[model samples]
Target: MATLVATPRSRALGFGLRHAREARGLGVRELARLAQVVAQDVSSWESGLRVPKLEQLGVLFGALRVAPPERARLVELARNAREPNWLERSMPGISPALSTYVEYERTATEMVNWEPLLVPGLLQAPGYAEAIMRAHRLPPRMVEREVAIRLRRREVLTRHDPLVLKLFLGEEALRRSIADPAAMAEQLRLLVRAAQPRTSSIRVVPANVGYHPGQAGHFVIFDFAHLPSVVHIEHLRGSAHLYDGDHVAAFRAAAETLSDLALSEQESLALIQGVITGLE
Candidate 1:
């Protein structure tokens, strides 16, 4: 049977150990004997059920035949796995499906987004957010809370070390009136204001651009401070967290293609201003 890896920290460490053991043609029992730990404990570490102490890591490293620096890297990966994300503590009762995306967002140094149906959450004006929520038929209190969360996410725009927010919005998103035309105008203005080069960027994919890569739905690619990049796909009922190399590559390609085909930042701002004027 496959061993269970531990949560964030121990999981990485355990994976490294297992990879090393497999490379050395050793079974779980043999690796456990070399590391001076029980096989079940090793399995638990691999499965993310528990983390390894520093001493335990040293033993694992010895068994894995790793040098000091490589061993340190494995240990650091394990440490990150063990650390609980801020979103886990701040919003305890939220859906589990959202936790991974939130963790990626809070820890990311760069974020790229593409939304076809509505304003991206981070850039949403409060009224726009509320209107969209109402349209979705969320309970009143839930709408308020979701709006609050969206507003809070905007802090990333002005942090001391702000993240790079590159967003692409479909022409349909801009044209459709989520709220009153006046409210939509305000939302468009907000998008323009947020698009300034220093803090954020906005690009519009014109209707003329026709078919494109992100035709299916919205997705976000998060580049974390030190961890691997992640892609988040949201659906009606749930969300998916993708971290494998191949999936990340596909999303990256799509983002690049969209960015290339979409109107430039300046042009997009002009387009949004035109919408605002028409609405007024």
Candidate 2:
């Protein structure tokens, strides 16, 4: 039986609520007072920790003065927040926040990834991903499930209208080999093949580049045509989705810095090819 995981719709709605409130220069307490709800409730809503009831949602939206179209969208999200789907069945160990990130990935028109450790999940080969999961001590069953989901995630790369992928990898990512040399070689070859300019742009930040923003960690920025951009930061325990304008802007600036410091597309491919040759 497939375990049911909560959808990220509430998180999306919370993001919309927080954006609407801040745009109106209203604090959580102030909005709570206007909406006749506790301040903690407002905080929980914005954090995506809780979903507001319909009545509370109505009052909160009214207090924030959300515009009609966006308000309608938020309402729809609140209404359908818990609908089940195949993602839950496929990605068994994925957290609610990650599920939300997956949804963002599915809908995003452009994705910017900064990976300092292993290869980014979307681009990971199944064997490489399995090696990674095992290294993390995941049970064999869970590792197989995760590898399957990771492979499914790669579909985004081949979709008819594929999302533009701007991938930045740290030098260490290439230097660090997974347990199996053959699998690592396959992964490197895959990376080189997927770095086409038209669909995906891949760059490598040299180890000698000295301290830079990417050293901070792995993160991804998803940009949508009609929705506000979001920054996702993953950690050992869980992940965080940053929706505030300033926070998102700061991450964007960091992405730009990393991009500027990374090796050119041709250079990165050459570096990857060199690694593959060494394995051969």
Candidate 3:
């Protein structure tokens, strides 16, 4: 059996497999017995330590009675499980990209996020997130889904073995009002509270900071304890998760540069509060 590298696609594929098995109430040995595979191999496939043969994946899906849409998605992920990078576009009903992102984010040890346009999702208030999504002209159902996801994502900060966050917010992001002043102010207040925890750090990078690494665009580096680091770049249309060593290193360097360009933590909180005062 060929072992699959712990790339983002493999991780996502593993998550899909585990979810399918759990949904069907099949334990590893039970699923393996039905699929005619070794229970240990099944564990490896579900942990992203190995890639299941396409035939084996099919058998497992048949055993689990996976739905057509989800079965197709898992098969696609298995096919691309060895890929070093995964680029995903938004899809109707639910976005595969978003689901993959959430899967990786949940297990990440630390996240260094640089945003030049808006607050990081984990730091965003429901009202603020809803406003931004509404401004994007998303379908109302999708907007509600995204808002709910955003709110749920914030719990990662307080969950056991919580995700450590390093956020660099752009000055213009604070200036660009969304929804209404009152809502924006509430959002800023939320940021202030989010910055208080030791596990989270919020810093503001002033606009026109002259040539900074963040000028390129926004990205996040998610460092994991046992898996390779993944660099995620998001845009208006889609998002890409990068696992190549060079790419991850570049994002790490960019995170360092952003740290240098950003205001001190205390100063950042002051600026956030100042923005909140202005809005009020």
Per-residue lDDT of model 2, residues 1-280, tens digit only: 3211223566667767887898999998999889988899888777555778788888887787777866777787777666432112123366445556666787789999999877988889888998888888999998988888877877887899898999999888987977488998999998988887998999999999889888888888888775557677876666666665677889999999998899999999999999888988
In terms of TM-score, the best-performing candidate is 3
Could you estimate the TM-score for every candidate? 0.68, 0.70, 0.94
Q: Could you list the CA RMSD of all candidates, in the order they appear?
A: 11.7, 12.3, 1.8
> Which structure is stronger by TM-score: 1 or 3?
3
Cα lDDT over the full model 1? 0.74
Instruction: TM-score for candidate 1, please give it.
Output: 0.68
Q: Which pairs of residues collide in candidate 2? A: none
Please provide, for model 3 over 176-195, each residue's C-alpha lDDT reduced to its tens digit, 9 standing for 90 to 100.
Answer: 97768988999989888888
The full ranking of all candidates by TM-score, starting with the best, is 3, 2, 1
Regions of candidate 1 where Cα sits further than 4 Å from its true position? 1-93
Candidate 3: the clashing residue pairs are none
Estimate the overall C-alpha local distance difference test score of candidate 2: 0.78
- Lowest-lDDT window of 10 residues in candidate 3? 1-10
